[model samples]
Target: MNQTTAGVADDLDPDIRRFQREMAAAYGRYPDFDRLPLTERRRIAEEVRAPWAAGGPVMHSTETLNVGPFGVRIRIHRPDARQVLPALIYVHGGGWTLFSLDTHDRLMREYAARAGVAVVGIDYSLSPEAKFPRALDEIVSVVRWLRSEGAAHGLDPQRIAIGGDSAGGNLSVAANLALLRDGDAPLSAILVNYGAFDRESVYPSYERYDGPEYNLTTAEMAVFWANYLRGAQDFSDPLASPMRAEVAGLPPTFFAVAACDVLADENRAMADRLRAAGVPVMLREYAGATHSFLEAVSISPLADRAFAEASTWLAAQISANNDNDSQ
Candidate 1:
């Protein structure tokens, strides 16, 4: 906390402030995002990717699966295959245009080990290159793939969950709706980590946190949304913005939020919508954390506690499958 950015305070959560300063010092400042080429931007993000505890099993397998014209890479983190286990099909978030499987590998591994459920991370195509329905279609495709072929990988397709952070969180909601529309079985649960549910960004959190202090700004968010969409018309598409979707019939959900994030209010509103729709929802907002703070799994206690709470919740949901299996 000794180092202070212009708008940030010296006494803010000492851990969060320290994490923010270190991340800025490593990756270029949040505002520099628009200046860098998208490719190089992703590269630098990879360079400073958080080093989450490598406490998982030694052996892990990752491979690319060409489904249709798109070749999506999926990495599986499983501890054992002696018994068919519940699976979590996860999507990583980078504003829909940044990071990849490698960026989220350690975080996925940590969950797989800690929760004792097999974790499957999907490496879907990015946007600006593939806009609108493309990424959403790809995520739906993987969820469909998991439902049909997961048993071969020792995963119980009948009992599965989907989870993600940020843009990936938005995709998780969209994918759940897409699957439900196709009349597929409901997902056991879904975990949304600090997701941007609304396209409008009209939430007060967006305005309040719209500064250098929080590490996410309205300017950078504009770029991400611009890159993800086909145009302004796409904002009306529920698949593009889950906050606009008919949220009824959604499975049980867990939303993890940062108190000081532009996306915070939208997530809160989403929980309200889900509850009003009779969908069970759990919302956890950690104090003093910022967007993408979970990436600080290796650094901040807030992230550690958030991760533990999320994993424990999902683990309980996955274990509930046993009662159904018995019946």
Candidate 2:
């Protein structure tokens, strides 16, 4: 491990340490997703992450919506069917090439049931296959589709929020920006979780967690970007890197940062930029958390607390948005 990572290793949460060992054992080594064949890498990742994805079958109903070209697979997790409710367009994070609706099903269900809003989990096409703006394009299409046809799915189009974790958080913000840029109505709010916002950013956490000690390495991040972007040209595109995008018109936002994550500083910078631009932003840093800790919500108390905080905050923002519209 690097010296900076070693220094911070002792301060990591006990559960995080246990998770790293557990994950290492399952994968036979730390995952180098960029080096492995796509199918093999996905299989190992899914198997290794399976244990932490624990949750009983969700009580809320679920259904799939097929949007063409983008083939944006919309998996809606509804809290109930008694009335129309606010909804969130949830994008899952796997560096834009891993994970699916099933991987994030429980997390989405927990948020849906807890927040009393429908969660539309997006299973968009992955990168190297779809590339940078393709996924972002699908996000835009999905958000717009949600706005136009949400009522048919028991969702209140005017009360929809957008959110995602890791790369998904990047897309969530980017999609909202795209919508506003296109002169569409604004989304209710945004939920970002440990997102990778800047493809070209260099932060302290990158060095501190540059090796396998923290489960995610800067080298792996580099691979992820290369695979997700068309080429070097895409790096500076504000849609691909939201930190460089205009932020003045963003909706109220709540994003979480893992104290030990490489992306922590980048996420912080995004929050700071948003707040500086007069956008309402709430940034939460969990003391002992690591990247993708939310995936362990079933097994980690820290993860659970993070989810609860996000859930409460999301419900409030969506509720406030609804109240404002009524007024």
Candidate 3:
């Protein structure tokens, strides 16, 4: 059954449909969005997403710092004035090209407030200009810095987790892999939300949810990959496409899969692979959700439910990690 031909929009969860409509209307203002240059496109995208990032659970304190040789900027959102706290190092999803810490401000704050941990959002270098491994290197460096120097910022080095959505998800896992290769897997947890795991392979979900109705299309993914990769060979590089990498010995992982997303199948496959590798895996599929659905937390109860569930799971993972560290 080719659901695309049947108009998949008709099958969208009502709240999700509303989100799509609102987002579409916002992007509709820029009729020449696709034809614009990368700089212009990104500027417009920031403007479009400003409304959604407007309001959320305010943090007890927020600080920005430039760390590492590359001066990677990270925004730390602490939920309360704790002398020491566990942290979730969050990477924002923008296909490795768009979005930033500012665009995902609310999302980070929500996690910090709900999960009772500091949310550290890294402003990694974006694609086409930065290329593969550049962002990955910066992320790994930031993790190391947090471990060695984070106490000054009130972060517990041994109780840190890393996570992100879409391309950010891909980097979160790749960073851990980089650490493992260096004989260090210090992260307590990994959170993947509809991540782009495999770049070289096409899955069944692409056919069913690749249309514009889903907010993420196959064509757009192709462009994002091209922008992020330096050459064709990079597609098979495990760090660039984690589905091709070794998954065993990683820490506990939580996957927030969107049932209607083009990346849904890959998220599931990654979860299964992790479980097979004997890693503690928590896979939760959000029914009737689409790509980038979590950004609708301001309006959609489905998005709210998904966040609440992920936060609960994240809190437990960090808490358990804390208890183990005490032992």
Best by lDDT: 3
lDDT of each: 0.79, 0.80, 0.88
What is the Å distance of residue 156 in model 2 from its true position?
A: 0.7
Over 50-134, each residue of candidate 3 has an lDDT whose tens digit, in order, gives 8988898988999999997889999999999888999999999989999999889989999999999999999999999999999
Cα TM-score of candidate 2? 0.92
Which runs in model 3 stand beyond 4 Å of their true positions? 1-8, 325-327
Q: Give the TM-scores of the predictions, in the order they appear.
A: 0.91, 0.92, 0.96
The parts of candidate 2 lying over 4 Å away from their true place are: 1-8, 29-35, 325-327
Residue pairs in clash, model 2: none
Number of clashes found in candidate 2:
0
- Candidate 1, position 127, lDDT: 86
Question: How many backbone clashes does every candidate have?
Answer: 0, 0, 0
lDDT of 3 at 96: 97
lDDT tens digits, residues 1-327, model 2? 111222336767888766655665666564464467888777777766666666743656888989745668898888776578888889988888887887788788888988888999888889879898888898888887887788888888888888888889999999888887899766888999999889874798898766565767787788788889998888888989999999888898998998888888999999999999998898889987888878766667888889889988888877634576211
TM-score winner: 3
> Which tens-of-lDDT digit does each residue in 211-294 have in candidate 1?
666877777788889989999789798888888889998988999988888888999999999999988888999988888788
Ranking by TM-score: 3, 2, 1
